[model samples]
Target: MIALSDTVSASSDLLSTEIDGEVVMMDMEAGRYLYLDRIGSVIWSELKRPQTVADLCQSLADRYAAPIEQIECDVLDLLQQMRRNDLIRLHD
Candidate 1:
């Protein structure tokens, strides 16, 4: 399981493109395509550089003017989905 202390980054192998404030990514290895909304796109952009999950939640909370707890919950869910899709890499 992923923890807030863990570091995460986008998988470098994906082929992605941005359009209308959203992002579309192709996981070639998985033979699948994924679409991200504006908020997801922001998260995806930030994940271009590896960062701790706690830090990412704080940053997003600030940007979206939301509570850290809520942000953390949403981010954790999204991160898990991304991980399952092999769209992200996690570090201890």
Candidate 2:
């Protein structure tokens, strides 16, 4: 499992675009495309640079009405899913 302190960022070779508050990502290596909703898009934008899971949760908490714990849980789950799909990568 990814720890809260682990930093993560988008893969360098992937292509991404934002449309109507959503994000569309294409993995050049895997030849797969993933669509992200508004919340996912926000997370995707933040992943432009490596960031800690805590930072991501707090950022979303400030912008969204959800609880911090819920945000953290959701963010962690999403990150793990993205990792499995080779969309985002863990950084040092």
Candidate 3:
């Protein structure tokens, strides 16, 4: 699934996330939370859009001037890691 999780509602626990920014955790499970860089932040925003992977990759490629194939690979790897870390959830 290219999309992060359109049906998986965003948790309020994650204060906010932005490109070139970070994800704040008010009630963090573990203190000193994980941080994301500019590229990760961009992917987070695209996922926030509730867009499918296809759309997200296309958008990322366009925004960053990268090849779609490369972006797709990045997205898959990052998303899998995020999912494993419970940083994100898939719709199903």
Candidate 4:
């Protein structure tokens, strides 16, 4: 399971591009394409460098008006999905 203390970063194996304010990524190893909305794109950009889950939530909370708890939940869900797709790596 992912925790707020865990560090996350984008996988080095992805080739991604931005279009129409969204992001499209291709996982080279998996040969799969993934789409990310604006918010997801923001998260992806932030993951260029490893960031703690708590730091990610705090960053999102600053940029968005959502509550910290909601941001945390949403970030966790998205990160989980990203992990499953091999788009991100987690470092405990």
Which window of ten consecutive residues has the lowest lDDT sum in model 4? 25-34
> Which residue pairs clash in candidate 1?
none
lDDT of 2 at 49: 89
Candidate 3: residue 4 Cα off by (Å): 10
- Candidate 1 residues 2-56, lDDT tens each? 8899999999999999999999998898798899999999999999999999999
TM-scores for all candidates: the values are 0.96, 0.93, 0.71, 0.95
- In Å, residue 56's CA in model 4 sits off its true spot by 0.6
Which pairs clash inside model 3?
2-53, 3-53
TM-score of 3: 0.71
What's the lDDT for all of these models? Answer: 0.93, 0.89, 0.62, 0.93
lDDT of 4 by residue, 7-90 (tens): 999998899999998999987787888999999999999999999999999999999999999999999999999998888998
- lDDT of each residue in 1-92, candidate 2, tens digit only: 98889988887777889999999988787788889999898899999988898998898999999999999999999999988888888877
Q: Which ranges in model 4 have alpha carbons more than 4 Å from their true place?
A: none
Off by over 4 Å in 2: none
**Cα-lDDT of candidate 3:** 0.62
Give the Å shift of residue 63 in candidate 3. 1.2
